[model samples]
Target: MFDYFIAPFSDYTFMSRALWGCLVLSLSATPIGVFLTLRKMSLSGDAMAHAILPGAAVGFLVSGLSIFAMTIGGIVAGCIVALLSGMVARHSRAEEDSSLAAFYLLSLAVGVLIISSKGSNVDLLHVLFGSTLALNNEALLLLSGIASITLLVLAIIYRALVLECVDPAFFKSVSRFGAVAHYLFLLLVVLNLVAGFHALGTLMSVGLMILPAAISRFWSNRLGVIISLSFVFAAISCYLGLLLSYHYEFATSPAIVLVLGLFYIASIILVKQCGSFLMKRASLAKLSIEQPIQNPSSIHKGQSNV
Candidate 1:
């Protein structure tokens, strides 16, 4: 167990860095993910993930993979797309989901075109799938900083967000800051996606943001517990996925996402089974209660007939 799990981090600096980076990412991204799931904006998180690509690609073209450049570019691009989607949904006949889908598809194509036009396939792969094992100090700092900002902002907007999820009409009526919280939450989503872009790439970053939240829903109903469980799920997935990647030479980003996928599948299966069992027990109990009452009625009827 030590050699398999503990040795990798101890023997390799990169492994340790990767683990730390992923843990920090889970800190901020998972809670936001819970809120995303709550708001039924899970797919919106995915759309914004792809939405950051063109900006990152542009930054790559300009700075040749400088973390700061790509990050800034991705954040700018993601924010623009998110804001545009929101505006179109409010101002036009088009709904938010359809508009977001259109923008993300276009953004993805434009990003791939830009990257392929200027850089090689390797650069494109890095932008799409991420380079998790190659994280340096700069990348670590960026992840940490983003996590800090995300957590602080989430704390500030916590109440509005809860109200927004629970009752949007009431939230709007009660607080003028509803729009502010909504937009700020969107901004945080973009920031985290940008941060995730550095480690998991545009394609896979949202996995870290969304999957654990999805899994946590199976286990808990309370918001606080769900958020806590999501972080734990994400952290465990990262550690195990990194180990798999280190030992088997799998792509780190996909491995991590795949592990999360496994957890999600397991959660679904377990929850379904538990629900079925509970329903069966309830039905049995109901039948037993009704059977005794019917038996007593039959006895009373027979006595009356006699």
Candidate 2:
């Protein structure tokens, strides 16, 4: 039983690297995801994830699975889509989300076409689904560097970002940084998604970002608590998902994401039920305490009347 849990990671360097890669990703990405959820940009995050695909596919076509090349390509594609969507929202009648959806759908179709036409089925699968258990030194370094940069930038802009979410108009009036903060936040989303794509693929990367944030809402109302719990939940899902993948030979990325999905479902039911139970108990106790006092007063009045 001990070996079952320990052997896979201890025996294999790849497993260890994968674990580190995912945990590092969770630290930075989960906080961004929390803010994204708070700002009601969950759908935008998903859209940006898809938007990175064409750039990555282009890199694969040019360099044949080079991590550096693909990372650059993905980042470029993601930022471009983000800027375009924002611009469309400002200049046109279409809403930001609607513009983003249109761009990402087109990007997805284009990415698929490019990969299918120029690359192999294996390449397509790798770009679409990721290579979690097969991470190399380059992938690990990329993930680490992105995580560091993400944390640093977020720390610097945390207050402004929070203000942007809580009161955009006040944020705009008080500081000239509202648009800057919004764009910067979107860039962070793209960067994290690019890093996540190396581990979970373009399709599953948003799951790592969005699912944990979704689950944390059930457990916490405070931003700090939600962010902390999001990271913890993401880490646990990654650990268990890796174990299950090793044991059952399931696809690692989807396995990790599906574990998170299960956690989400469980949180919703368990937290709601617990809250309801406590409320019911409190209500009953209040009624019971009041009942005796009211009864004695009524009896005293009845005796005086007799």
Judged by lDDT, which candidate is best? Answer: 1
Per-residue lDDT for 1-306 in model 1, tens only? 899999999999999999999999999999999999999999999999999999998899899989999999999999999989988999999999999999999999999999999999999999999988889999999999999999999999999989988998998898899989999999999999999988888899999999999999999999999999999999999999999999999999999999999999999999999999999999999987897676888767778999
Best by TM-score: 2
The clash number for model 2 is 0
User: What are the Cα lDDT values of the candidates?
Assistant: 0.95, 0.94
Off by over 4 Å in 2: 293-295, 298-306
- TM-scores, one per candidate: 0.93, 0.95
Error (Å) of candidate 1 at residue 86 is 1.8
Model 2 Cα lDDT, one tens digit per residue, 1-306: 878988899999999999999999999899999999898999999999999999998898899899988999999999999999989999999999899999999999999999999988988999999999989999999999999999999998999999999999998888999888888888899999999999999999999999999999999899999999999999999999999999999999999999999999999899989999999999999988987786988767878999
Which regions in candidate 1 have their CA more than 4 angstroms from the true location? 282-306
